[model samples]
Target: MVMKAPVADARNGSVVDRLVGIDLARGLAVFGMYAAHLGPDPGEGGLVGFLMELTHGRPSALFAVLAGFSILLITGRKAPKSGIAGRQAIARVAIRALVLLALGSILGCLGTQVEVILEYYGICFLLVLPLHRLSAYQLGLIAAATALVLPQVRSSLLSVAPNLLDPVFNLMVNGYYPAVTWVPFLIAGMAIARLNLNTLAAHWRLGLAGVALAVLGHGGSLLALSSRALTETSLWWSDVDGAFEPSKSSFIVKSSWIAAPHSETTLSIVGSTGCAMIILAACMLAVDALPRLRKLVWPIIAVGSMSLTAYVLH
Candidate 1:
């Protein structure tokens, strides 16, 4: 049975009527980031290393997807608020974006090994203002198009200019969370919100979609790489020239895709998006299946509820 949550507004203007499952997922992201930051290096080589590696890109990708979900939650779930309410929501998001940007900037100046993502988060939020109005299908198409094309666009521009070192350029296209390609995660999350997530059927479809995309993306990348190795043809969608190694292979070879974390290839985008969707769907399903589990994971939910603070404190 679907649990219907009572909608409540927060006095502080934060969205309070949250999906517990999402909070749980966010909590996991927060904790996963901790693991990513504090855990042993992936190069350690063992089950522990593998587990540590898993924490690397997926948590942050999950965080970005949830960021999109949070955007919808802040504005209006499944639908954008209209007129005055809409304007207020927009303003609120804008303000939050600025706060995150400022906070991220400050944190970045501290010179930690961890790349601050909040500033980029803020940039994406500001970009989402007009975008929040698009239909789920439209947003999905935009996301797909961006994932498939934006990275290539950026790569070509970079190769041509080589010195496009402007702050805005870096923030939008080349940064840790490049808004150019990375915005797809946010858009995908928004599309998820547009769906009828209250239904078991919906949950199943979301999960299935995740599986399908993961297989398509990762499997395709492997196939492409293998093909490149065999054929000695460097068919690439990412910056092939940058990754090309003549000594490694007497014949230059680069594939059209890469599944490596943060590679921003079509495959990485698709696979990471799939992984995020799977996590989100699984969290939602688990919450629905075992309502009692909420009590068990209360600490995680609590951290997720205060994710920003937790992130900053870290």
Candidate 2:
């Protein structure tokens, strides 16, 4: 959890010159995906399902927020000079997203495990492109709205206009994001960029807020899940194929244990909680020993750093 200290001189080889915590978090996030899906299917009501519900969906959110943070941190420098960095920033993300889209398609077509997050990340990255111009607060508001509307928007689009919804549309809708869409996460990252969230790592209050937000976001989702009772929802649907549906491949596997209606809310709450905690922990894990752990976690951190690469490669 401890990250290497930041070395301001990018010309010099310094872990801080690169985003260490994000890489570590990314590495952890990918592994979480591997574990949650590649392992045994946790039936909707089983113990493993419960664990998956809590952890599986959370890391990506964290990954995505970091994605935005990275984009801003890397590109924010130009915002002050001539908006030149901002332009380059857009181009960088655009090229990366296109590659991801292509990679996602390849993974979906070729891999036995067709759950391609590369597509979602690619799509989300594109969505964030325009939001780059907005202030952090504006971006955050947009993100919040996107989160609230995404599920409903997706459901309606699928139900009413499946034919109109082409493959790319499907990829964006039921394909990748599902209920807890990554768009908001991307925007949250963008908002951070618009504001200087990285600097806040030094602020105790901000760190506490990150903790509080994590607790509240995760806990509230859990409470809501417990109270809402998915059995009552009109949207409850299951694959019932008794096989891992690659089409339905998401961060979480298609298992009966966590597949029940009740688990949806549970997953969101736990996932969000995990996301919040990971971010907070990443920031403060090892102020002293980060230099050493950084070396240890470097591979994982690289995985985190090249999440797009990994996602596409997968």
Give lDDT: candidate 2, residue 70.
Answer: 66
What lDDT does model 1 reach? 0.79
Q: How far off is residue 288 in model 1, in Å?
A: 0.5
Candidate 2 vs. true structure, TM-score: 0.71
Tell me the tens digit of each residue's lDDT in model 2 across 1-314: 22344545555555545546656766777766776557655456577765664445555666666777666665562252136755776787788779877877777788565466677777877777766667767776786677556655654666677566576676666564542456667676666545543443443444565666555554554454345563322112222232223354432232212322213322333335335445644544543334666666667876876676675555
- Candidate 2: which stretches are off by over 4 Å? 1-16, 44-53, 77-84, 162-165, 178-180, 194-207, 214-218, 221-292, 312-314
Best by lDDT: 1
State the TM-score for model 1.
0.89
RMSD (CA, Å), each prediction: 4.0, 6.4
Q: Write the per-residue lDDT of candidate 1 for residues 67-96, one digit (tens) a residue.
A: 998888778877799999988988888999
Which regions of candidate 1 deviate over 4 angstroms? 1-15, 230-255
The window of 10 residues in a row where model 1 has the poorest summed lDDT is: 232-241
Point to the candidate with the largest TM-score: 1
